[model samples]
Target: MRLSLNKDSYEDVNLYFQDEARFGMMNHLGSYLTASGVKPIVTYQHVFKTTYLYGSYSPINGDSFVWEINGVDNKIFEAYLGAFSNYKPKEYKIVVIDNAGFHSTKHIKVPKNIYLLRIPPYNPELNPCEQVWQYIKNRFKNQRFKTMQDLKKWLHEMINEMKAETIKSITGNHHYVNSFITTFKI
Candidate 1:
């Protein structure tokens, strides 16, 4: 639904979210070994990369959410599209996203109720969800996990603990977005 009093072309309500992040041994980048004299090596038990977390953010309502994902595929993204379509049933939902392959795959059936605004190729800076992911990842940098499930659990905990205000403060402060909001009093 339109919230602005001014009838502007920017009537499309931009809701940024719907991205994925992998959490596994591959994600661990801070492992180090230390010793007194002779260097003692630390060996990490090899665990295959296994989990993917999909999340979405609503700039208008400051709703930052993580979708329960079993795997990463076109079907997963389609499900994400369906969920977001239902999330804001009344609003004219415009999701700003990079052209990830899954997002454009033939298997992905984007809901008619939602519109996808694909950002220019290679321009991730236009999408604020990248910043949201970086913020979360930075918090878990160098963390070592026992198993894939443990990594998934850690991700869930971290995401759950993220406050809406914190997400807004991080992902909602885009220069162009803020300028529009200010200019239109949105």
Candidate 2:
């Protein structure tokens, strides 16, 4: 789809893929290295408490904005958009997202500088932010957190230490970059 920007200048326009992921006491079990013949035993948690991480990633430049919230709802999503709007006030942000209930434009107010573009339903693969979530969740594999604060603290440190170049390597898919270039003629 062709997106026509209301802004006259495209110089500061940025394309971002946004998504949310739940991180909690529940551990993600991934492959583990063990003795050649040994079955690796991993501990798992059933705690239901979770914090939702709302994130927006610009594959073009590896720019990212993230917020940790208790849950997902229209109100919370609106606030996230507002915060992201202020985070990069000068840029015209075009955020591509999946069709989640909280992402419905009808229920939430989008910030003036931000435009929401919904990808086709059930097409999570199209959003590069999925890779960001995967990269983060992988870090949580085979791990346990004593409390929500500990999880949040670890998450904060992990996010802060992430370099833009590393993010670009993880999320900068050629297809997405090419689409952005072709669509925006950047």
Candidate 3:
């Protein structure tokens, strides 16, 4: 009856990638020029500029949907909920989310089919959908995209490439999900 709708943002920012090389030469005297010491790097024109992307993840079926938004507001939140409804079309879907302003706004119109359940304040780790962001961010870590479109394309590709079983393995190990399954037998 209740499906946990997790809402979060993923941003694309250019930053220096971590040191990937493992092997480095250490001179006996002091230090010498080494191949590993000079690592290849990718530089971008702007580092502070970021592209904001919002999404909702469904832990029940290992499904995720994303959108590029200029700002986060109650209207957009309602629009996303509508999109979620169109995507899944469940009769009584309960979404568990954090206390974000967009999610809890008075102006937002919640669809009759969707019910929202807010988690405790400041507790994001308890949400199983957080795992979805963790997995995606890890996959794109230390990498810089040439453009926002490129980043979006890559994210879409990576998500599409992942199988449902893989998504379940990545995000389905949470206590809440287990409890839901046990109680509902879903």
What are the runs in model 3 whose C-alpha is more than 4 Å off?
A: 1-45
Winner on lDDT between 1 and 2 is 2
Which TM-score value belongs to model 2?
0.90
Q: Compose the digit string of candidate 3's lDDT tens values, residues 1-186.
A: 434433331111010100001111111122235577595443424434444456555555656566655566678778877876665454345567777766765877787556677778898775666666567666665456666667657766876787767666766655757666675566
* Candidate 1 lDDT over residue span 1-186, tens digit each: 233322343344556655787766654455456765666444455567667778877655567657856687777788888887777555555567677887785657777656676778897777778888888788776677877677778888998888878878777756756654765467
Winner by TM-score: 2
**Order of all candidates by TM-score, from best down to worst?**
2, 1, 3
What CA root-mean-square deviation does each model show from the true structure? 4.7, 2.0, 11.4
TM-score of each: 0.75, 0.90, 0.70
lDDT of 2 by residue, 37-134 (tens): 99988888889889988999888988999999899988999999999999968788989989998787786778878888889999999988998988
Query: lDDT ranking from best to worst?
Result: 2, 1, 3
RMSD of 1: 4.7
Better of 2 and 3 by lDDT: 2
Over 4 Å off, model 1:
1-14, 31-43, 105-107, 179-185
